[model samples]
Each structure stands twice: as C-alpha cells, then as structure tokens.
Target: MMKVMVMVKATAGSEAGVMPTNELMEAMGSFNEELVKAGIMESGDGLKPSNEGYRVRFSGSKRSVIQGPFVETNELVAGYWVWNVSSMEEALEWVKKCPNPMFEDSDIEIRPFYSMEDFADVDTSGEFRAQEDALRHTLSLQKASLNNYLFFSGRCEEALNYYVQHVGAKIDLLMRFSDSPEPIPEDMLAAGFEDKVMHCEFTLGGAKVFASDGCNDGTTLSGFSLALTVATAQDAQRVFAALSENGQVTMPLAETFWSPLYGQVTDQFGMAWMVMLPAT
Candidate 1:
C-alpha cells in the first residue's frame, strides 16, 4: 500500500477563521467515519487559521520567525489527512466522496509520499533505510493498543453482570446473537443460547474489555491473567477479596519486592486475574 497526504488548501474564508457549521461538521464526521471503515484514513485533523500559526525561516543557520496570516492564501493548507491507499486513483475516488470542506470554492490536493524503496539507488549502504524502518516500527507501536477478549460458553451475560457487581465494570455495548447483522449458524449455538451475548464491550477502570458467548463449545478461560494495578493497598485488598468470592486464590495478597500488595485469583466465571498495588 502507498501513503498519500491529502491537503485541504486554504480559502479566503478559511484564512478569515470561519468555523464549520453544525450541519457541515456532521456531514464531515460521517464522511470521516466512512473513510475509517474503509481502512484508508491513518490520521486527519483540521488546523486553526494561519494567523494563529508561525513559520521559521533559516538563512545559513540564522533563523527568523515569520508570523501569519501570510500572503498566498491559496498556497496555505487549512487541514490535511495521511491516508494509506492502494493507489492514487483510489485516493482520488475517496476524496470525491468527501463533503465540501469549505463554505465556498476550495481544492483538495493529493500527494503521494515517497516510500523507502524509492530511495533504493541512493542509499547503497542500507543504513538510512534501516533507520527509517526502525522509526516506522516505533510509530506503528505507538498507534497500536492491547485489550483482553474473553469467551464465555453461553453465560456471557452472567459473566458480565458478575464483573459489574465485583469489578465495577460498566458495559459499553452488548449485542445478542439475534441482533447480529448476519444470522449466526444454528448448529453453532446450543439450544436456548440464541439470546446469549454474541459480543459485548465493557470498561474496567479505564481499560476496555471484550466478551462474547462463543459457539457454546465448552471452551474455558485459562492460560492468562488480567493484571489490575491500583493506587493503594486498601484498594488492592478490596478488589482481591471481591474477585476471591466463590473463587480460588492462587496466591494470597502480600508485600513483595515489586509491590506493597499483590495476589492472583480465578474469578467465579473461571477468568484469572492479578491484583496489585505498587509501592509509592
């Protein structure tokens, strides 16, 4: 895939700091959602008027700051998006579907970014390419997130409610098998499991957790533990005790080299967890 920078050129109105109307904002928001669903948009944002920005000029290391609203409004960029697209044509097609970005006449410019392969002839030693690859790897890591997804054999709702009562988890979304866009196979679910949670999302503290009543194949949660870090030993003790109710405690909460309090337990639904309070 190739990357492209889509620039929304500044218009006279944009340079004057005209804000988008609510209707226009909604339209753009919907358009952005489409781009995201298509997996083409990497990052995008609108910029404040150039008057609120500044430019630094260098003359043989002698630097001077130039304040804006600079001349040449047509040359200035009001906003931009970094998109990963199959080709320039695909980028153009997506851009065509965008809502009118400006209140008046405006232009959106699509420019392809130069890939590392494009510099093959110049970087004969491969050192610069390696550096670029490392930087990109770091960027990808920065953009990535990790979450725990649990499967409850037909008792997903029960498991979620247990978490709500014990862990103070808040359900964000819940979709039953019947509410699925495509019908789930009948043979996949055991009888009376049709109303079970097909998928659900919830928050424990600040972390998001996913759960589903997957296919009722009697699969059990094992091999991993959710690590819960709290600010105080009292909080850790409270959570550890809550998770231990009607469950097994593998290790009792106590002071260790790493934390003031720490313990491991398997909750009522068979999910394992580690609760700890780091020493201040």
Candidate 2:
C-alpha cells in the first residue's frame, strides 16, 4: 500500500508570539518515541524556523532568490510524518493516538501518496496490484460508514421492531436491558422501568440507526425526526399506518407532487417519523 503523510499546521493563538517552549519540545520528543515504538510511524521531525529558509525561483533562465521569513506565516506547514500503513483508515487509527503537538488547537491534514504503479496500464499484474486492490477496498468500506446517532427511551427494544417492520431496517446488533452482566441494584432496576433496550442497531438502505433504552430515569426524544423514503405509495401508506397505530399522526398521509404519499408522526416514545413514497 501507499504511504500516509500527516501534515501539521501550527498557529499562534495570542499576539505574543509563535514559539515552542522547552517543555513543549520535551513532550514532543516523548511522543515521537512512542510513535516510533508503535511501528506505524516511519519517520518524523520538526521544521526549521521560516527565517532560516529560502525559496529558489526560475523565470525562463532568469533565476531569482526569495529569502526567508515570509510574512505569511499562517500558510506554513509546521511539521509532518510519513507512516507506512496498509490503508488510510489504518493511518487514521494511529493518528487518533498521536500526541497533541500544540499547546493550543492546531489542524492536522492526512493524505495518502500515490504509488508509481497507479498510473500503469491495466495489463499490469503482480503483488503490487493485489496490494492496491486491497487498499482500495478498505477505503471504500470506510467511506460507507453510517456514523449514525443513537437514541433511546423506555421500551426501546419494543420500539425497534416497529421501526424495522415499517422501515425495512434490519437490526445489526442488540443488547437487551436484561442482558447486563452485572445485576442492577433492585432500587435502580425497579425505579420506574419495566424493560429497557440497552442497545440496538438497524440498517436501512445504506444507512444505520442505533438506539437503546430502559434506564431508571425515563428518557424522551425531542426536536429530532427520522425521514424515510420508500419506493411506492402503497408501501409508504402501509408503513406509515403501522407506525401511526402505536403513535400519533401529526400530518395525515396524502398525495403530493414531491411524492405519491407523505406523512409525519410521533411514535409512543416521542420520536418523530417522516415517510415519503415515490410518485406513481
């Protein structure tokens, strides 16, 4: 796989100055040692001050020299590292543990380098192609991540079935309230809940939804809604009616130019649902 390059941009927070203190330098050295031992990092180093740098320019045989200490310090890259990893995702996993380079907030940009074979003809066949294909697949899977937000209230497990039936979302994982390894204290367990859904995940189309419930203190969903689009008016109406049976309808299902059927409702737990079906 190609190498991953992590570029760090430094900035001066206060007008006082942009200089690394001795303590900060020591911290960076320790952090770099950790990275080296992890085996993911190949090499890294700090840059010389802009004042010690020079730029060479060529204007059609009229070579010119632009000296150091450019006024535009904000545009400069402070430091960088080259990491040998199988994929960008692997590189990101390593980056998450990277030591904070700045005493204040700074931006880090991660990019993958292209190998020479990426430009080669399709007829090329070798271990290089295999590695490239694997990297591409890994990146594709990372891009497909849903990054869904999870919510829950009492009886979330029961609610999950309703959503799955109407939305065609299958539960990928579930942790029921009763499945906790440690026994919940009697007072806490019997506070006010009958049953809770510890955690549950559902996938509809290419998206994911996660939820849980059954805490002693009741939870309620507010100011949020899930929007769903179906393929046909019949499907939409069927799904909406099912969801509405145990919930309250805010907008009656009806035909519209945008979709053959559309409606909104708040399920029994206070979670809002919106349904849309393609126009016939």
Candidate 3:
C-alpha cells in the first residue's frame, strides 16, 4: 500500500486575494464530501493565507527571530489531501477528479510517502523491527501524525567515518558483508553487491550511530536530515570542521546556550550533518 499527499499550488492570476466564490466553494465542499465517502481520503485541509505564516530562526547566544509576510506569491500552497491508495496510478485516478480550487488552470503536485521498507538494508528480524512495526501501527491508528525529524538514506558510512576520524568517535560495531554471521547468499554475491557494508555503527561521545549500504535505488538524498549533540564547544568545532570538509555548510558553527556551539552541514555524500555541544 502507498500513501500520497496532493498539494494544490496557487498562482497569483488565479488567486485574487479573496475567498473562493460561492459556486467554487460549493463545488469544493461537494468534492471533499465525495472523498470522505470514498474511504480513501485520510485527511484534507485548506491553508490560511501565506502572509499569515512565519519562519522561526534560532540564533546562537541571541533571542530567536520570526520573519513573516512571505515574498513568493507564485509558489503558495493553497491546500492538501492525504490519501491511502494502492499505487501511483490509483492516486492519479483520484487527483484527476479533484475540483479546481482556484479560478482556473491551477496545478497540483502529488507525492508518495516513504515506508520503512524504503530504508536501505532495513532489518526486519529482531526487536528493533517489532518496535518499528508497533510505532507505525500506532501512527496509522492516529491517522499518521507528523514526526519532528525525518530520516535520511545513504551517506551514513561517510558521516560516521568523518566523526570517527575527526570528532573522537569510537567504533563500537562495524559489520560489513564479510562480517555477517552466515555466508553471503549466493544470489546476493552473484548480484555483485555483496561487498557493500551490511550494518555498521560508531559510538560518538557515547551516542550510538548506525548505518547500512543496502536498499538504495540509485537516487540522490533529499527531504531528510539528522541532528547530533555533543559535549563541549571544542568538540563541536572539531566535529564540524571535519564533516564540513569537501561539503557545504548550511549553518556556520556558532555559540549557543542550548549548547555551547552548534552548526549544520551537508557532507560530501549529500547527507545533512549537525553538531551541538553543551554550554559550560
């Protein structure tokens, strides 16, 4: 089964800065009712005007800031719907019938949500798998609430290595294909992918780090990130400099009371990296 979210984009010409006309509102309500009756729709909602939204920024050693009155009118998201569908084809079938929210000629973006199976080389044979299943079941029962942080794919090895080499990370467990309990399956060996790391871990200043090299579909990383917390400003600076090499910095390392130092970067493997150290 697949979960999808349909996003309707509002354009300036189609949106005259007022509420929808009565006729359009009625049509939309009818469409929504139909969706509710179909049992495929999980949730839907219209957004408040974009001008009412604000961006929050956390500044180190300073008060947070809020910036509002968005400037990008062309990319406003008017509304969205979450649906449980069998396939992309099924999702498209529903989206095709959605009533136009704007005056006319509006565009909608349909994207699928990733399941645990989407994780590369995910383990399904132990206590961890059971915990994951239980959590997912709970979330589904609650209609899929949003999680504060999203998980990323690939780049785990590179990030861990960087931490070990530069941030004083101790390798607690490093399991490569050669280190597996059983021989590499014949099919897997024949596929020329057996040399990849199966499961690996690094203990960075008492925090456990995990990674794997299987389960990728050859796509670059997007829409996920990780946060790391350390012990001191010097430790944060050391880890940040090491990971930032050959990578781009999203936020420069700076002093913060939340931690003595904090920063974020995307490593050479295109995975986001974060470092934080406690204030003295």
lDDT of 2 by residue, 87-186 (tens): 8888887677767777787777898887746656753656677676657645543433223434555656666787788877788988665666656666
List pairs with backbone clashes in candidate 3: none
Model 3 C-alpha lDDT per residue in residues 1-280, reported as the tens digit of each score: 7899998886674344667888988988888898888767888887766666676676886766455456676577878999988899988887888777777578888999977676637654566666776575444434411111222244446666787789998867665666665666565532434555565656666656545555342344325456666544555666678789999998899864444677879998997876665434
lDDT of 2 at 230: 64
**Stretches of candidate 1 exceeding 4 Å from the true structure:** 147-163, 171-202, 209-280
Model 2 C-alpha lDDT versus the unseen true structure? 0.68
Error of 2 at 72 (Å): 2.9
Write down the worst ten-residue block by lDDT for model 3: 144-153
Alpha-carbon TM-score of each model against the true structure: 0.60, 0.38, 0.43
Find the candidate with the highest lDDT and give its number. Answer: 1
Best by TM-score: 1
Compared with the true structure, all predictions reach lDDT values of 0.83, 0.68, 0.67
Worst 10 residues of 1 by lDDT: 137-146
**Candidates arranged by TM-score, highest first:** 1, 3, 2
What is the C-alpha RMSD, rounded to one decimal, of candidate 2? 20.2
